[model samples]
Target: MAETSITSPHIMQIVGYKNTGKSTLIAALTRSLTFAGRKVAVIKHDGHDHFEMDHEGTDSYSFAQAGADAVVVMSEKRTALIERQAIPLEDMIKYLSRYDWILIEGYKQAPYPKLVMVREEKDLSLMETLQDAVGIVSWLEHDKSESMKDSEGLVRHSVHEAEDIARWLVSLECHEEKRRL
Candidate 1:
């Protein structure tokens, strides 16, 4: 994979095949980053053709079923908008640029700085095709050997080290901020 510049420094992606703990890692990162006083937003890619958000008996569900193009529900503390169409990732990122960190889950082919999850030896092949991979989160203990060095400056971390990974991501954000200054 060719080296790619970080176009959006606040964006970082966690990508891996199914059952590779990508969601778990992203959840951990969100909690840690939030506790550290950073505003974080997450965008997840669902490969499935359909996903359910509103329950069948809910008002939102009825509105959608009535062919409403968009349904937005708001309360004192939270708001959610469901559009009938798929929004492109770039547009979503632009809309969420106000957040201090946008930790994306999935979208493996995106050129953002990413931490690839490797569950086994075969999973390491993803590094060959993914662009701008900054690190690796491995599930297997011995998979951190030299054979895993698919790119220069790629750091390796165990799946258990969520706090360490969070710290690493925070440091990267700080470094990028400094570079921009």
Candidate 2:
């Protein structure tokens, strides 16, 4: 993706332990937002391994290994890269400001508005650490056709349908708009 800068951007972080449907929720949310004509940006935090360059033998990887700060790898099909230095989350947000909203995956510890996935009762503790959680996505038992009624402080939705999550996001944006005005 071509790089662009953003400012005072709205962000939503999806966080939970492994297999709690965090990734699935993000995918649904993105699809929903995209269909709604809202531009969406995404960022994923990979806690398992150090950042690895894509296309290992590609020229871009070779350039980065040779100390190139930014290398763009392009083919007729697609393009990607491995880069040096860790860009802060804020900087990434700045880069994504052109989009209407940013949906971040797996930054459970970061201070951002969030739509956290909680599969079990034990995982709810994550809510304490998150700065502000706007919503929740759960795979647990609840009415699937509509938003869950039990979400006390925030909205809740089933992660099984992209449209449902998308509608929820739209609702969130609407609510935020009202609060801002």
RMSD of each: 4.9, 5.0
Candidate 1: tens digits of C-alpha lDDT, residues 77-168: 99999998989999999888778789999998888999999898888888888999889999877634557764679888999999999888
The lDDT, on a scale of 0 to 1, for candidate 1 is 0.85
After best superposition, candidate 2 residue 52: deviation in angstroms? 2.1
Candidate 2 lDDT by residue in tens digits, 18-102 = 8998777777778777777778888999887666755578777677778888887678997664557678888888877788779
Task: Judge candidate 2 at residue 131 and give its lDDT.
Answer: 70
Residue 54 displacement (Å), model 1? 1.1
**RMSD over all Cα atoms, model 2:** 5.0
Off by over 4 Å in 1: 1-9
What is the Cα-based lDDT of residue 86 in candidate 2? 78
Instruction: Show model 2 residue runs off by greater than 4 Å.
Output: 1-9, 74-81, 143-151
